[model samples]
Target: MAERIQKELKEIEKNPPDFCSAGMVGGDIRRWQATIIGPPGTPFVGGIFKLSLTFPPKYPMKPPEVTFKTKIYHPNIDRNGNICFNILKDDWSPAYTISAVLVSLCSLLSSPNPEDPLEPQIAAVFLKNKVQYEEEARKWTAKFAMS
Candidate 1:
């Protein structure tokens, strides 16, 4: 598991995506902390979103679990930090890697999916109160994710 993670890490280092910065944290080979720079033109812009990645012993076969360490106001994210992403759940595949997951998450920050929502209230906010939603998201980012 560690070897596979290291191999994936090397690939990420060579050509990282533009959204987030990732690295091993707390000196744990199995744990990583990623800092996502909220996407431009989105409510999350200029925000620092922190996420923790924990690989399963059977990772790639079983998807890694990602939870936001930083509070975020999104329909797909729950108050308890669970995310409502299909690929991260029952749709996981062996071909998926840490980089792929991170990329997906970064995309989600920009274009949120309302069809599958973890926080139902956020769904309503997304449809009816976009400006308010952005305000709450920005507030949470400042309170929790700022350096």
Candidate 2:
């Protein structure tokens, strides 16, 4: 497991994903920290979001637990930073890599999935009034995600 994690780390360092970077939090290979620069042309653009990944002992067989350490205003992400993305849940496969996960997250920020949301109220707003939702999302990004 540690060997696999090290390989992934080296791969990331050699070719870091666009708008994202991740590394071990400390000496523990099982814990990692990642940063995602919100995708361009989105309400989250220019915002920086932080996330934590906790890998289980049997990683690859089981998906890592990912949570946002930085607040983000999105229907798929709740106030507590829990994510509602399917790939991170039941759909996860061992074939998926950390780079793929980060790329998917950037895509999510670019186009959110309001149909299956963690924050239902936000989803309602998103579904009913997209302009309002985008305005609020931009505001939250400015307040909480901008450094």
Candidate 3:
């Protein structure tokens, strides 16, 4: 196991995030499974979202690949579970930790960023009809994420 990976695992174990829980997947420190609880007052409240993270050997130097395992109806996430968050992309820095990533994800759920969307259709709906978007997102959360 990589030293960085071990260190991250230890940190996560010591100080877990409030809205999420994450740990090694199948005993592989490089692979992680995360469950993020939806934030209150959002359309996603009461939903439990699952995610997968795969770290590169050069972790802490490079951002891990993160994907939503549970279905979500958000502008920043696509049907294929790909997330288009800036922190996971060009804005990433080694100073970020796994806990930081999870907290950021929780924030994203609480507030969707329609400006930079992975699913343009969803973004359009979110921008044009916020009520409709919230309705659909809430429905999807109840249908898919609740399980």
Candidate 4:
């Protein structure tokens, strides 16, 4: 796990996204602390959201668990941090790497998958009222991510 993360860290450092950054927590090889700048052209823009990534003892063979430690108002993420992204679930492939997962997560930050929602009310809000959806999302971002 250490070697894999060391390599990944180098890759991340070499070509990091402007909106995000991640590092192993407390110098532990298996746990990471990450921050995502909410995507542009979305209500979440300008917010800095936090998350934790925990790799399995046998990573690569199995997917790691990722959760948003900072509360966010998104249809695909539940209050309990259970992500409803397919790539993290059944759609995952052994060829996928941490960078791929982070890219997926960043994509999700702007374009949520309404078809596979974790918070039904939020999904409904997204479908029913775009203004309200953006407002609440911005509110959550300010409350949980900006500070």
Candidate 5:
């Protein structure tokens, strides 16, 4: 498991996904920290979102637990930073890599899935009024994600 984690870490360092970077949190190879630059032309643009990942003992076989450390205003993400995405849940496959996960997350920021949301109110706003949702999302990005 550690070997796989190390390989993944090296893979990320060598060919990192655009707008994303990740590394071990400390000495523990099982824990990782990642940063994703907000996708261009989106409400999250200019924001830098942080996320933490904890790999299980049987990683690759089981998906890592990932959550936002930086607050983000998105329908798929809750106040507590829990994300609602299929890949992280039942859709997970051992073939997926950390880079793939980060890329997917960036894509999610670019195009949120309001149909399956962790924040229902935010999803409602996104579904009912995109302009209003973008406005609020930009506000939150500026307030919480900007450094």
Candidate 6:
């Protein structure tokens, strides 16, 4: 398991995503810290969001537990940073790599899936009041993710 994780880490280090960067935390290959630059044209643009990925002992067969370490105002992400993405759940497959997951997270920032949101209230605002939602999202990005 460690060998597989190390291989993935090496691959990620060799060819990292333009919008996201990830590294193992300390000596633990199973734990990683990721930083994602918000996609351009999105409310989160200019913000740098942090995330934590915890790989289980049985990885590849199962998806890693991803959580936002930084505060973000998005319908698909709850206040606690729990993500509600299909790939992270039922659609997950062993073929998916860490780099792919990071890229997908950046894509999510650009196009949130309000229909399957983790935060219902945020999703409602996003659906009914897009302008307001953008405003709030931008504000939160500036406050919490711009460090």
Task: Report, for every candidate in turn, its global Cα lDDT versus the true structure.
Answer: 0.85, 0.93, 0.92, 0.86, 0.96, 0.94
Per-residue accuracy of model 4 over 27-137 as CA lDDT, tens digit each: 887898878889899888989888899988877677889999888999999998779998888887768877778878989988988777999999999999989999999
Off by over 4 Å in 3: none
The clash number for model 6 is 0
Model 1, residue 53: displacement in angstroms?
0.6
Give per-residue lDDT, candidate 5, residue 108: 98
Candidate RMSDs in Å, in order, are 1.5, 0.7, 1.1, 1.2, 0.6, 0.7
For model 2 the local lDDT of residue 144 reads: 94
Candidate 2 lDDT score relative to the true structure: 0.93
TM-score of each candidate structure, all chains considered together:
0.91, 0.98, 0.96, 0.94, 0.98, 0.98
Per-residue accuracy of model 3 over 51-70 as CA lDDT, tens digit each: 99999877777899999999
The prediction achieving the highest TM-score against the true structure is 5
Worst 10 residues of 4 by lDDT: 9-18
Better of 5 and 6 by lDDT: 5
Structure candidate 1, residue pairs in collision: none
* Model 3: lDDT to the true structure: 0.92
> How would you encode candidate 1's per-residue C-alpha lDDT over 1-147 as one tens digit per residue?
788889887888787778877778777878888878888888788888888889889876788889988889899999877899989999998888777888899898888888889988988888898888888888887777667
Best-performing candidate as measured by lDDT: 5
Worst window of 10 by summed lDDT in candidate 1: 20-29
Which runs in model 6 stand beyond 4 Å of their true positions? none
